[model samples]
Each structure stands twice: as structure tokens, then as C-alpha cells.
Target: MSALDTDRYHIFGVCTPKDYCLFVDYVIDEIKNHESSLLQRIQETPDPALRVWRESTALQGTDIFEIECVKDRETAQEAVEFWRAYFHSLGETIIEAGHLCDRLD
Candidate 1:
């Protein structure tokens, strides 16, 4: 079993059931495949009603797929930076650079 960190980040928002399902599928695949694209991960939780995630790697729980990356400090920083840039590129007003990112060690 992969160890997960819960106090790293928080992902939450609004989206639809279909979107949430898609998000979950995407997340499962990403984690399974060990894909490290912060942008894709950040946007995995699509749009519709409500969706939330974080950096705890616990997105494998609850509804509306969440991405809480619970990695070590070193690896976690890299993930956070990647997501920060991606979130900025997405131009998400609510999801700022550090929205789905964890503070560096």
C-alpha cells in the first residue's frame, strides 16, 4: 500500500457526477501509471456540481475524486511546484499558484 500524507493540500470545488467519475478514473490511472503531471492532476477533478482534492494522495477516497499527494518533503515540493505552475497556467482565479500545492520543506 502506498503511504499518503493528509496535511499537505486541499482540493475542493463544484462539478457533475459524470465529471467526478471521469476525474476518479483519471486519478486512478495517474496513480497506477505513476504519472507526475501536476497540471493534469490538478484539473482531474472536472466541473459540474462540486469536487475537492488535496496533496494527501487520498483522492482514492470519498466521492468526486480528490488528489491529496502524501509524498515525502523532497518529492512533495517538486509535485507542489509543478501543480502551482499548472494552476497558474489554467488561470484559475480561486485555485491560485499554491491552491493545490504544498509549502516547500
Candidate 2:
């Protein structure tokens, strides 16, 4: 099981390896063009209960992401929606979305 299974965080996002390189390149370019806007958004929120994370799996060429809110499910859902909108605004395609829950182990 992953650490997410043991943590108090709820995670969700989309993934795709089909256009991984293009996606990554676009992300880098977008960051360069919109770093200020991105930073401003985070600063504006500044929610102590919220955490955002990203991971790139080389073997799978998959980029997995999650918005972890150290709060209730409602808060988590809100955070996920916020990110979903942000990514969509950037023209990123979300192939899937879900949450990470504690394992039964």
C-alpha cells in the first residue's frame, strides 16, 4: 500500500501516459508563463488544512496528482474541484479522478 493509505489526506486527480511528454512540456511552459498567477492563487488560499502534491512515474509515464486536505471529505472535495478547474483552465485533460483512502491492512 502507498503512504496515502496511511495518511490523513484525501487525494484525487487525472493521469495519462499517452501524451506524457507533450503534457510535461506544456506544464513547464505554462509554469514559465503563469508562475505568478499560480503562486498568487496558492498565496490567496493559504489554507493550512490543504496540501497539493504531484508525482511522475517514469516507468508508467504517468503523472499522478492529488490535493490533500487535512480536513473533512467536504473540504477535500472542494479542493479537488478547485484543482480540477485550474487544470482545465490550463487546457489539461483529466483522464480520471478519485480519492485515496486508508487501507484495510
Best model per TM-score: 2
**Tens-digit per-residue lDDT, 9-90, candidate 1:** 3332322333332221112123323333434445453432213434332333233334454335555455545554554466
In candidate 2, how many Å is residue 7 off? Answer: 6.6
- TM for every model, in the order presented, reads 0.28, 0.39
Q: What is the lDDT of residue 6 in candidate 1?
A: 35
Worst lDDT run of 10 residues, candidate 1, spans 20-29
Q: Which lDDT value does model 1 have at 2?
A: 38
Q: Tell me the lDDT of candidate 2.
A: 0.37
Angstrom error at residue 57, model 2: 14
Model 1: how large is the Cα RMSD against the reference? Answer: 11.7
Residue 21 deviation, candidate 2, in Å?
12
Query: Tens-digit lDDT track for model 2 on 1-105?
Result: 774443443343334464432111111112333434433433343343222213232222123333443444455556666766777778876433233222211
All candidates' lDDT scores?
Answer: 0.36, 0.37
